[model samples]
Target: MTSPILRDPGNSGFVVELEKFSGPLDLLLHLIKEDEVDITDLPIAKIAVQFLSVINELGLNQAADYLEMAARLLRIKAQMLLPRRLGDDEWEDPRAELVRRLLEYQQIRELVEWLGHAADARAERFGRGYEAPPPDAPPAPLQIDLNDLLAAAERVIALMPDPNLHHRVVPRPLDVEGATARILALLAERETFGWRDAVGGGPQATLVDVLSTFIALLELAKRSVLTLSQPEPFGPMVITRGISREAA
Candidate 1:
């Protein structure tokens, strides 16, 4: 699909081309796909910042729907920052509702695209006849709305197999302790490593493993066992042995 071009408000001569999105939800989905992160496990803080950047760049602040979605992202980001209370093992994720909406929107968008393609193909196969309808023919009744499409999407999704079922069969909790030990072992072999290295096994590593390793890195940094640095926002994190590790 061709991207749309927008004139820069700051500079009269500057023009920017951005991917066309149907709405705020479509924009969010595009950003998520660019990051290549799972919809179920979103990095809310990062995604929120990216979302705001896109809105500001396009001068969409005046658009009420876009502004509303921006506010929603900020709220979710703030909720995720709050520390969990002790003994509260069932803390619901702040991103849950947003994720659900995004999933539903995605399914409906796909269905619509499929339907459009089918209609085009049918049109090609059957030539349009020049017969006019009766003068008193009734207009076609409205058959579908947002609610109907959402319900149909839900039914389709319910019939599909769960993607995470295999993980449920052999559930392994996030192994922070093991992750820490592995990081230490890696440091023993080298002076520095990147986030992917700490996580290990490259693409084979599961999301749970990546998250647990990240937590382990934070713990190590807190104890002065390692130093973590990122050159810029949304950049790769680098790990190096700390002064304490050197002394030890």
Candidate 2:
């Protein structure tokens, strides 16, 4: 589905069907395009007015995420309204910070656009049956033994020894209690969501969360709470909750 947040307001002069605004940067970009103004010397009053108009239209729920930026714009507008102090040769422009932030946003926006372009190119290639270029491999193998691998593994384990030597641990703190709850909630709503989506953009969890979630998910798999399948190695595992029973 297309993100409403990225849609352009119509070309009609008044009473635009405002798409959902994601954040302050989105609002600022909208105002910039609307006014056709340079970022450096943006008319604070005009931009602020446009911003307020959009906010009023957005109402409370949609506006909550954007309040910080709206407040910032107001602060800048306030500074612009105030008279400069006496004997100040170089006055700091109220628009400077806003300009800086907008520039950064623009850079990121360009990056996203570039990535989208690349993705489209990749899609085209796939559509045309493009095979990936072969990976370069070592000219010769540097052979090592099973004992050497085991000894290296032991050394690493010794470096960061777990204090509790003998404990059949119930579960780690980063256990998936909350994540599992969230997963269940999502499944209840969506029926089936991508396993990758279940993880969200992750903040991802720490190693503990990843490990415990994997273990917990494995347990859930055993209990037939969910089904996990890897149709393709190195691809995302497909998960459909409340199906199939197999040891994780």
Local distance difference test scores for all models: 0.81, 0.68
1-248 in candidate 2: lDDT tens per residue?
A: 33232344444234333465546787789789878998888888778767766665555214444656767777888888889888898898878887998999888889998999999888775355668898997676646677767776774565453586555344556757866776677767875666556665455334565565577667767777778886643345666777544543
* Candidate 1 residue-wise lDDT, 93-115, digit = tens: 88999999999999999999999
Model 2 ranges off by over 4 Å: 1-20, 60-62, 85-87, 127-248
Backbone clash count for every predicted candidate, in the order shown: 0, 0
- The local distance difference test score of model 2 is 0.68
lDDT of 2 at 193: 64
Model 1 weakest lDDT span, ten residues long: 1-10
Candidate 2, run of 10 with poorest lDDT: 3-12
Instruction: Kindly report which residue pairs in candidate 2 clash with one another.
Output: none
